[model samples]
Target: MPKPKIELHVHLEGTVRPALLADIAVGNGMAPPAPSPGRFADLHDFIVTWNATTGCLRTPTDYRIALLAYAEEAAGHGAVHIEPIVDAEPRLGLDGWADVLAACVDAAAEARERYGVSVGLTPQVFRGQDVGYAEEAARIAVRFAGRGVVGFGLSGAEGRHPTLPYARAVALARDGGLPFVPHAGEAAGPEAVREVLAMGAARIRHGVRAVDDPDLVTELVERGIVLDVCPTSNLRLRVADPGRPHPLTLLHHAGVRCSVSTDDPALFDITLSDEYAVAAGLGVDAASAYAAGLAGMLGTDTDRARLVRIGRAAFGGIDVGPAS
Candidate 1:
């Protein structure tokens, strides 16, 4: 039986295994930066590393290899489904983005055939990108809807860059029939989460700070938006309250649907399994934590039920309650 896992808030560049990144970078004449001991420092540090890796991914084969490697690692972590957020505007190039996206889809399908794990793409727009860039990505997503692109996401740095600026792109995605999973409350406060809510994000990535605002927590619970929580990633970035003060428990108690994930396993040196263990330590029971993960991220009811069955089989007679 497959180990039950689903990761909804992963970035392909962030997930690149360090060793592979080194090899790929050297091969491309862009030597990877020296290995760092910490997962991440400030957001600026992360962005710098992000640019360095992005520079290495300059070809179709490079994109395919990066994606396939991520799929392999995700499957190893028991991930039945992995949605890699692709910030296509910068990396894939506007003119050749479609071909790059097609290559990614092919990689995903191949991973499923070989590893028994499924993968999907989420065309991600950087929060700092202007409205036109967001609109362009959204238009492309609309053009290729259902051709391996499962959802639309807003990734990258979140701050004073208002999510509302991307409203048109998000609306285009919704009109063209795609789900919105925007990153919020990761670096900012609950007000940032509220902003995404107003912009109609179906899921909130790293919404740990919602606990800081009881009203916002109530709003999230009432609306049933899944908080794509990344405990290790948050700790590594120092975005969340330290240790016990982390909002995983508070969000769970508040009735917000929340899922555990490794936002960037390579950087954090963790995996979905490690993430689950962290959540367990944070007060969620083993079985309930697993169930919360499945419920919070699975794209369909059928998939969610399949995960529940897998959980039951793996844990044996332990009931993993509904994510809701």
Candidate 2:
């Protein structure tokens, strides 16, 4: 839709197509989730569905298939670069974690060569999990540093496990020269956003609630910490209604560095293009959407020339200032 945009905050496991998950489950001796999984009542319910889908990913082949499927989907949406969060610990046992990461890198390399789309892997630690697990993820990330691994992230429930819990892991990742990104302000409020900021987060995933704290918003804008905001996920999670009460517009107005993304497109039945379409329908002008996308590209280490080309082609030009 936007000529191969960059997707910054998507989870590779959660983006598994339902049909593929069923197929993988059958192939891998696992049971897929129930037919409809009873309509998700909220974000927690959605996570339940997500874990079930992730059950399909029990082997390296499954990881490869998931990566390839997501790459193909991103390509179909005209996404040139995709940054998918990877959790080697869950899918690949600690002893074989390096092999797991290597498999993902190889799969992404294959996708780039065969499909003409680039995918960068960012290993993630599920917060609310043992802090030791995060440290282990960081260690493994450091081991694979500079080898197709671009950044590190923290996912899972942020409200229960405070951002400071992973402070040491973030520091380790940053020390190893990886960009630090953590989930914050999605289910939690603006306070979570502040905690992530204190932890030296380079980019925040789903920081929509940062609008609730003007001082923090100002600091974010000043420091250039990009928020990868997924609008459809916000609405589906009941964090915000898409139309009247979404704080994304307010965050942009407050000079927050924000970007649009599809958090879990398959789970939510949406895509990067769908995300852009929803934003447009919800009153975010084409230019603002373009800037948001630019902020995302700017926040990452993607190809600058390609980003500039897409930015100009998408909106004729990019102002890259606060949305007014």
User: Residue-wise lDDT of candidate 2 within 107-192, one digit each (tens)?
Assistant: 98899888777777888887776788678878888876666787888877767656677788888988997878778888788888
Give per-residue CA lDDT, model 1, range 151-199, as digits (tens).
7888667774667778888889878877888888887888888888888
Report the number of clashing residue pairs per model.
0, 1
Cα lDDT listed for each candidate: 0.75, 0.75
Give the Å error, residue 282, model 1. 0.7
How high is the lDDT of residue 246 in model 2? Answer: 75
lDDT for model 2, on a 0 to 1 scale?
A: 0.75
Output the TM-score of candidate 1.
Answer: 0.90
